[model samples]
Target: MTEPVRLTDIAELAKVSEATVSRVVNGKAGVAAATRQAVLAAMDQLGYDRPARSRQRNAGLIGLIIPELNNPIFPAFAQVIDRTLTLRGFTSVLCTQSPGAATEDELIEALTERGVDGIVFVSGLHADQTASRDRYTRLITRGLPVVFVNGYAPDVKAPFFSDDDAAAVQLAIAHLRELGHERIGLAVGPSRFVPSRRKAEEFRRLMAPVAGEAEVERLLVNSLYSVEGGHSAASFLLDEGCTAMVCGSDLMALGAIRGARKRGLSVPRDFSVIGYDDSPLIAFTDPPLTTIQQQVSSIAAAAVRALLDEIAGLPVPSTEYLFQPELIVRGSTAACPSS
Candidate 1:
């Protein structure tokens, strides 16, 4: 037999009074929905199974599809989303994919077969400009509640959550310019992804005032979203007299540091780098990385609210919700060389 649940434990975990926990646990009618959700989330966090009487209160299961867990940012999004769903009495089913692993289509098929009430996709196929949008179109036609994150497709009739990619590039440029770095360059992901395209276009637009439009293209390098990709892009830009570089991710920034070291140069002394995605451990790196912070918590909350509205048969507007990004300055960047 399972151990009896304790009201004090739930109260402490939920940061609420024992009386409130008592009301929620006993299924009393006066407990506020917000308080009840906090209690449920606390119970889930503590691995306490709900009382048998409360089994019927579960909202439903939600499928959360992500590109991969290799990047710290993806897991960061997953943790907040899972916690939010549990608080609202919904279960989260996480699906991850890699280059050679289960394709996105396979994951979607499995999720649909399992009768998931709704789906939340993060950096899925919808972000690929070259990919067919028919998959998302079919889901909309079937009336399934879905939300996309970090990617936007005009043809997909679902709510989209994305960080302002163009603004991020602009922020980096402005900061580097203030540091007297005239030969600034960008190292971003492949051109096929929506974010990559936006960053590139914005970089060119801003650089055109400094360098002609044709010369701006020479300072931009398209590569993978990895450390090696950053190294390669940085190497090319450095050879072209670039004293500072902006990378698509922190991993790339670290790689760019390595590239600078290989050429017998010290970071912030001979070169400076800025990265995107202020992930959890990024601040603790060798030289705490300067990065663009995506408002993951707010975006995840908004995405969940939209999905819940759709699930509840409420009128949810199909529009793109853009979250502003903040640029975090740290030790990895410095004034340009005076040589």
Candidate 2:
């Protein structure tokens, strides 16, 4: 080998001191496990091929494909999945899609080509009812370990992990109803997505009595799962005298807030809004959003574990695993204007 490497170099990469690297190098064994891992990771990151005799193989890699990162919820899920995978000794490679760049199909091909031991698709095309199911069937036929999240397609042989969208809507409606809001509207993404579809269907059923013909018609607004969409949808509902709104995503809720403000009204004071996903940064919002909180930690863990189970040839339940969402009460909701 070349002249003995300096301990200081490893310390810098590890963000520790030369003494810490020395301790790890000498195998004295008093280093905190995290610190030891840092030093070891630093070595790997530096491209210093460890002496063959001292090298250790990694557990394996998993490919995690997400739709986009603009929405905070996507990154929140990414963080949880990444940490959970790393802790379980699996390295997760996150591939996020850009507007016009590589699509999910391309990402799937790329990951499998690189030999990822398994893959977890979060809010991917698998969740799109219109997308061809053959793509997933092909992967299944090839025996690639895969898990689906936030959507269910029975034709594909993979475990589906999703939050209870219907239950989420039910909770939002009950919260508003209890607060004395009679004319409540559901602002959601297109009806194509599974979650949106589930919410819309449930909302109509739950509001049928309190929300009559003309009231319900003007109340249901189909908007994109975005802020602008929320703004636009809320504008229409506001004209119909809707005093409460349930949005599909936190971003849309932010948009709805903007919508309410445009009409010279304040949130929870002029109108009550509820959002889904409880995406990161929402808690810090101006009024803080009252939202249906997805049990992200549990959902992420279940997805990872299910993928691993599939990889080992162990059979996992094929049914959709539904986790109930809890409603987080924050400043965004309150007694209806009249109540």
lDDT against true structure, model 2: 0.86
lDDT (10s digit) by residue, model 2, range 123-213? 8887778989887888888999899889899888889999999999999999998999988999988877888888888988888877765
Question: Model 1 has how many clashing residue pairs?
Answer: 0
Scored by lDDT, model 1 comes in at 0.90
* Candidate number with greatest lDDT: 1
* Candidate 2 ranges with C-alpha deviation above 4 Å: 1-56, 213-215
Location of the lowest summed lDDT over 10 successive residues in candidate 1: 49-58
Model 1 misses residue 162 by how many Å? 0.8
Segments in model 1 whose C-alpha atoms lie over 4 Å from true places: 1-13, 25-29, 32-56
- Residue 180 CA displacement from its true place in model 1, Å: 0.9
Q: What is the TM-score of each candidate against the true structure?
A: 0.91, 0.85
**Cα lDDT of all candidates, in order?**
0.90, 0.86
